[model samples]
Target: MSDASFLSFLDDPGFLAAFVEVSRPRAHGAGLDPYDYDRVTAPLASAHDWPAACAAAGQRYAEAAGRAAAEGRGVTAGEAYRTAARWYHVAGWLPHPDREAAARTAADADEAMRRALAHLDPAAERVEGDGFAGWLRRPSGGPAASRPVVLVVPGMDSGKEEFHTVVEALLARGSAVLAIDGPGQGVLTAGSAPEPDYHRVVGRAIDALADRDGLDPDRIAVVGLSLGGYYAATAAAHEPRVRAAALVSGPYRLAWDELPPFVRATLVQRCGGSEAARAFAARLDMTALVPALTVPVLVVEGGEDVIPGVTNATPLAAEAPAAELLLVPHGNHLLGTALPDWLPTAADWLTGHLTAQR
Candidate 1:
């Protein structure tokens, strides 16, 4: 009864628990109004209708942005465009093995975010290199002084457009920000396969950044969320430039047999086959990597974020030599439901380490 098709995948009632009410929290975190979330979900007749509903919502915001732009309302146009991008991102966030609608929507989100940045952060620079694409942005005033950098890595089925708050936070802290989509991620997904050796991707990103003026090549931190937390930990262990690290909801390890149908399907598709996914899952383990983290490391955990068949990052923190855990008892996955409680605190922790680093 289980199939890789997006429709069939969602139609399976057993798969529903993978993301119990995940849409609303993610939507809220992406800046969508609570009423807008209701408007989008309330009309969906079934789980299969989610993509279209979210897509329609994205279109609505996109059209509103067009009107706002034409009417010379810069701020309104920019905000609407950004909201449209987030909606499109949400629409594509599902790990649909089929990849058709999700691919198109991811591209839409990318374009919309690019437009949004024109109005919001005109100084933002697009950075791209092998297996990575992102924006490298400095703080508001300008890049007058060489500043430490913070690289933001998104998790499974997430892209750069989804983490504006992270970027803004680092910028506000007087650090440069590079938010990227790696191999098999975001717009780069269609032609690429999921890579378990994510440190290579981080290395390539650092290679691109190391020579840039106004950036302190020696001081770079990484803030990774969800699966990206795995990448950040791996990079901190291997990439010497990563002086500090923070992982939110990252897995300590992945077991193919234990994963839910939705996760299995997504991995099968992203990894290109069952065999490849199994191999990749094996590499997701951080047992040997955490002990190598000589840099300051922060692990953020949501007490309610537990999902069946998945190993959360809590144990990994305990093992890392210099790791600290920020466990939020009331928070859920991504902590979108409890953003105010964790984000500022996490951001402060990262900035403190980055600035304090000699």
Candidate 2:
């Protein structure tokens, strides 16, 4: 609960791994299960092998995704979906350029999406925005052009690919979707952008979505995974155009004071050692900055979360003028796979707000 306790937890490598394992069910349920779950479970697990496993998983996922796209399944095919999930898992476990490698895996995912779209009606387009950018996926069937729109944001370590399942699910529900690589995420991190000032980066994403063709604009909803939740909440508050918002396995308060030690250690490890990790940590002040959002908001939390405790969601719900909280009993930090059950709830809530625009 306190900052010290959180930091202490982050310092222990064993504890971090254990917490991750415990969080697996949630991630698995959410469709983001990593490939190393079984391999990493061996006693005395070798950290060195983690990268190799991640790379292999990424390659496999790329191939599978391509196959799925060719089959008109949009990354939902058993092989492609599993591969994408493995990429998320592997990326989390892999090292530096490995993170970059994970992004590359995401690029393959983009290709898969493109391939799938090609099979559809080809309403997709590569759009350029102010601070951020992405490809917009619109429905292809007919001119029944009144579909709801969703703006999907990736997590801290995730890229646009991670939301492949989410996009498919929303699209199936007759909604147009836009998935983007926000700052410090995907292409932005690989490119010149630094860790973005949340407001500026997400505001630009909203700006981009609002201007797209055939989009209801008024029926736009925002969904953020992991750290994207913070950005989504902030954007929903400041940008009135976002009718509703959902925080998927994301925390409410920034927890500048209380990040679990395992998380800190993981960051340190991700940055390639302890010193760099500390330096990176110093740059972040996790305190929740958004006061109160008027938009209809859905806050999803993991019951056994190690990174951001379940308690974090409480304050966020309190901060939102109209908010609903869904606690996944066995969930972790990843909520994408849990879409089957959660998406409907999300769609229902969003429909109430977005459809009322008439």
Top TM-score hit: 1
1-358 per-residue lDDT for model 2 (tens digits): 3223323543345754664566455445435545555554444344444445545655666576667767778535545544544454444433343456645654555554455455443567766565566678876577867667788887555667556666766776667877887654554544433242565666666566665667776677888777677667766776767778888776544433365544554454444455554555554332444454777888877664556422355456665668888877665456433555566666666655666764
All candidates' TM-scores? 0.94, 0.74
Model 2 residue 340 distance off true place after TM-score fit, in angstroms = 4.7
lDDT of 1 by residue, 1-358 (tens): 2334423667766344435366678767767788877867765655666666677888889899999989998889889999998888888766654477778888888888888888887878888999999989998885499898989998877888888887887889888999999988888878887777787898899889867779888789999998899999999999888899999889888877888666777776777777777788888988888668888999998999977677999997778889999999988888888888888888899988988874
Q: Give candidate 1's error at residue 34 in angstroms.
A: 1.9
Off by over 4 Å in 2: 1-23, 26-45, 61-89, 92-122, 140-142, 192-196, 256-258, 265-292, 306-311, 335-341
- Could you tell me the TM-score of candidate 2? 0.74
Superposition-based RMSD of candidate 1 using all C-alpha atoms, in angstroms: 2.1
Best-matching candidate per lDDT:
1
User: How many backbone clashes does every candidate have?
Assistant: 0, 12
Cα lDDT, all candidates: 0.82, 0.59
